[model samples]
Target: MALSKFLGLFLIHIALLSSSCFAADPFVFYDFEVSYITASPLGVPQQVIAINNKFPGPTINSTTNNNVVINVRNKLDESLLLHWSGIQQRRSSWQDGLPGTNCPIPPKWNWTYQFQVKDQIGSFFYFPSLHFQRAAGGFGGFIINNRDIIPIPFGSPDGDITILIGDWYTRNHTALRKALDAGKDLGMPDGVLINGKGPYQYNDTLVPDGIDYETIDVHPGKTYRLRVHNVGISTSLNFRIQSHNLLLAETEGSYTVQQNYTSLDIHVGQSYSFLLTTDQNASSDYYIVASARFVNESQWKRVTGVAILRYSNSKGKAAGPLPDPPQDEYDKTFSMNQARSIRWNVSASGARPNPQGSFRYGSINVTEIFVLKNKPPVTIDGKRRTTLSGISFVNPATPIRLADQFKVKGVYKLDFPSRPLTGPPKMETSVINGTFRGFMEVILQNNDTKVQTYHLSGYAFFVVGMDYGEWSENSRGTYNKWDGIARSTTQVYPGAWTAILISLDNVGVWNLRTENLDSWYLGQETYIRVVNPEVTNKTELPMPDNVLYCGALSKRQKYAKKSRFYVNGYLRKMAVKTNNG
Candidate 1:
């Protein structure tokens, strides 16, 4: 079968002139109804969340600078929030989708999110943020195309395809959450799925009926751009195509220097685009493989997910043995070396006219330095919890953004530490106070046994450096300041440290957390709270008109909300002039 298609981009252009017309960028909108449905992605029947009755939600096809408005109607019994994984909610934090920053849409209620894709291009994704919902369903590809004026660095491919590969569990999300709540560990996944499908003939002997795998129909001697996203909840995946090399092109909306490899390590919450040329024999199909990386094979079943790459005129299926994966080495140096090889194509234009590295990040002085650390989960007061810098994140009873906007005190503390603390972990609603427009250096120290992937919302930071052993002042000497690829999510291997340089130009409270869903739920997360003392309409948008005020602010405040307006297809923020309820 052909690749599951994306929602067609409807360009609603209005001509300004009669003869030689000028058309503005159009707004892309979708009314999404999130509800539950019975599906068997793992060959076991379970209820999964669906958007508009589609299991994997809907792929969003949009362009840079285009305003995207999604009206999400929640029909699940539990609350729901959807985060645009790599989309920087620049100047508009009200729609960031973190439960602490924005309120969740209650059951049977709906909320509309409006934000500009602004100066971004390439692969990304959106998924449900509340609870372990993502383990069951609710994820889709988000592609931002470059405008006509911008030039693509590589030759145009025959077509673009998106693949969502991840580990799967037979237990439903609710059962998984209950297990975690009871201080239990979720063992290995039952299977791995590609594009919301189970393995080929995985349960044919065990069960009479089972879900099948994905098949990508391709033409001989033609090339295609495949955008891959590791939407898995936990496991880190290494993806490969049999008898083919994956030409790395762009990652998480940034163009990278072209490099070819047989296998690629994709951590949870990561996205990439690779150019695959169909150069092999056309008589038989090929296997598309995604296997769990850093997983022990002796004690547990090998997590191998497979799909098919078929030629249009093919006669039979694949017959050869699967490609050999890299040996499971305790010291994962080969993957690290491969990651280090990916660099930014500094000369290529992204969504804007300027080159990728037009801003000389090395020349800029860092205003602040932070050394955050993570440790393995420990049983605290009869519950397993993960800590970031000695603090277990506690979600506040109200939205922190609404509290900060109304100057409500005591909603959250801004005393989050810049370094790990000395004693046992503590739970608090805490955040890091970041100076607006400050170029900062952040080092994430991973002392945990497993590889950790961290994701920063509202901004894509530069991965400057990473190394085994502990990080120190001397580690700065090994930094890659010249051409660090900019991306939202990065992996720091076990017992390793990764440093990033981020300029806090966006104003708002943003989530900085590990991508592991269990850890995030158990509190391996924090927020960077950036305050612009001289906030303006140009610098920040006003509070969303539909914001559900709670906590301290709900006690007294009510106001005629000054909202935004879509002026001729562009989003324009209105000034706040009233405050009283």
Candidate 2:
């Protein structure tokens, strides 16, 4: 009997240990400090805001469903908020770093962000979301690896590479914000950058000396997974490798049909994964170039950010001559054709591809439709603002999510229009509310003459269709009813409209705004509230205990009386007093 009992206890101990090993999840912690550092991207010295004194901040590598905790200490004079781009903070929207949903950490204060990267696997990034701070740096990549249970669609590459492409400005971020605040338009960029360095040429012959170029090293006859992200504040970039082909694999978190292309157009707030084989001549290096595309046709020139793809065995003092890329930056036909070719890979492993809640969106019933039309700039309350559907959004005196949770009144309105209004632009708060678990569609119509890119927080959407002119009932026939790709950010061409379908599976306040920093800062944005249903916790979650309140909410909380109150058998008086007083 003694021996039997000892054996039983040993088995139980072994079982517990096995379970713990299988269920272990990593917790990533980062200490981020926002400060100024001198760097030269265009060979001209300038002060840029950096995190931990490193420009293009540190990359946070994590696995799916892992918890990420970042302690941010603000050292700048301005308020700072960091947004995890393309991260669907599922059932944890309070962790999303948006000004309308969370309070910023003031100078010298520390704020901690704790959330799980649930059910997501892809190449994403993080950047500052306030006061045009992104242009001055403090951005980094957030890469999430897939779970062991899931199989990747493509073959495993020998290595992985990340390239961040963007346009650079010589002026300080504050000066640019001041110019925009004064209603002056920010013209073209001084130069473009690839991984924070590039060549800048003033006039035709005056080129900056001692320019550092970003270099990529690879072995001959080896394949690599290249994760490319367009993190620019403005302008669309076309990435290409001279004399080489690219096999596209994924976008954001969705597996896409592998297609071959020589060049790819990546708009702001977008990311893509491609398989690049270093099958070229190993004796010589090649040029990898990224240039501005779809800008003003008359002003289109050879403004490009270049890097060298050097072989590991090659020895060379110079990388020979630069290879030529397509000079037609204004080719609308080519651009649109490339955009239409991106489709979800139905045959990929673990891909649902169903008619509802999957790649094929045929049987999915869109419960609501939001028609957002972009109008020209207009002066409102002595400031030039960009209007979305005739309303230029104004920040409330408190965070919308906090106000909703505490039942604060007059913080925002729930009756935002579903269609654009005709007439003069007006300064107003635009917010649309939807029932939890309701599938919705948003149609973005660009009425102006420039390309527009928009990003949605807390969720990724299926890009169903895009077409020229205004969207109407007749436009439904042109929609990509099947095989629409899922992405967090998408672009709408000039005089065209883009349609995206999303499910309100996450209950919280979300922001839908332009990726263009100028337009976003000038009020081309709005919020959406997902109301929780009483039955299920799948779409709704409990409020985090450590959330910070600011603005008017802070004042009310400070002056409110705290007394004993009980309704649900727990102490609810603190929340009641702060919300009601």
Candidate 3:
């Protein structure tokens, strides 16, 4: 009887332990209704796509390892898909929100993205991934805090701040899309915006009675963590606060080596976190400036945005005059130096250096290399398209993941070339097949005179090297093999190249594309299919039941009525050949 009582006591202890663990990791939920909203960001009334009728959507805040459930309902006429920028969906690639991997949530349909933040804690974001809607603003901040047990590498700030820097256009989304489709560039933005509001300027002159600028209130002598994201469709922005040195803390999911800087160059689709200690004189306010860089550097006079950093104890709203901006936006020497200085904090207690995690990238054995080059503008199928390795990518009739999951054929081919294309551009669907868990080295060569930024979905790559000239086998010696920073997006200088090493640990069809929205729409993108040798519960789970299949896959049932033949669970209709019928 005494032994039986001891066993009961042991079971009770186990149950209490399990209950405490469950309480530590809680679920966070959000319902996002994407619809049209009328708001004036630049003092001009314009209709924009927003979530829950808010201009900048809603900010998502949660802790690491929490299951985040976001129910997105598309109420607009067009379809919608939200890309969780820098959130390495891990093995759950279906929630990556790439059009090639997951089908778009059609208009009037609601889809819930269920996934875990999982070992990641840093500054990230979410934005609409379809129909150029990101420019229209269905974007928001996605902040993940460290769990209770995990100690942050840096000191806790007194307060937290989030700023989104981007270029704003006066024209509507429809007008912008039509212009791009007509083989014309976006030219230039009306002005830059900080958190969706700034002085409306044209031709270097502010509009009469422009809207009030966005203000960030802070207490004196307190340090604040400022998380910034460059969510612009195009253009690189250099962000700075007058007379304050920024202590770099983090970038995306990796904790960076803390360094002090006056200005930070944030490329498109990139996010950064910096610590701003307000130890400056509290007598006057300061100016937070975000100026356009790399694009139209000659027209710097009209490419700047400003905001106010107000101290709580300041007397008046006088934010003084703007300080001198970065001397030269096109200074490649200065930009390259800043980029090289960003290194990974190897001693940080995170997945980056943990031997048990998937991000032990320092010891990875690279198995394959892909050399991609950006070619000159070329015409494909009577439309101007940006060439990537001679193949201007085109979206297939059906989503590639669905096609692959059902074993359907003809959606895409696996003959994408790894070497740079030699002569002319061609109309082709570039689909590169990859082996699961294989380490990959991607070299991006930019022969054009324009600077380019590239973003990869589902994984963050280590920025190993950025060379001035072309990339070759000899350039491998210049790689920063030890302390290179891991990021989801990187910039390639004009007439130069950038190399990154990534491990294909996530199984899904992922997209590697230019951050320039116009270039992406013009086919400067490709897909990598990471196929698992065996579909198992551990490697890749089965497709969720709620996945919405669209495009050609939806029409296959109608075609099956005419000609009945099953092709990999999908009905295939044969075409009847005739002489003159």
* Best-fitting candidate, scored by lDDT: 1
| Better lDDT candidate (1, 3) | 1
- Write the residue-wise lDDT of candidate 2 on 264-353 in tens digits: 989988999999998877666677878787765345453578787888887653344445555655555677768889998867764231
- Once superposed on the true structure, which residue ranges of model 1 sit more than 4 Å away at CA? 1-24, 202-209, 299-302, 328-331, 352-358, 553-581
For residue 124, model 3's alpha carbon misses the true position, in angstroms, by 0.9
- At residue 396, what lDDT does model 1 achieve? 88
Residue 352 of model 3 has an lDDT of 54
The regions of model 3 sitting more than 4 angstroms off are 1-25, 200-204, 295-298, 328-331, 353-363, 555-581
- Residue 12, model 1: Cα distance from true site in angstroms: 19
Candidate order by TM-score, highest to lowest? 1, 3, 2
lDDT per residue (tens digit) for residues 186-284 in model 3: 888877778888653322344436575788999999999999999888888889998999999999888999999999989888999999999987777
User: What is the lDDT of every predicted structure here?
Assistant: 0.81, 0.79, 0.79
**Backbone clash numbers for all candidates listed:** 2, 0, 0
RMSD of each predicted structure: 7.5, 8.2, 10.1
Error of 3 at 305 (Å): 1.6
Candidate with best TM-score: 1
Per-candidate TM-scores read: 0.90, 0.88, 0.89
What's the lDDT for residue 479 in model 2? 85
Residues 407-474 of candidate 1 have per-residue lDDT tens digits of 77888999999888998888889899999889889999999999899999988888888999999999
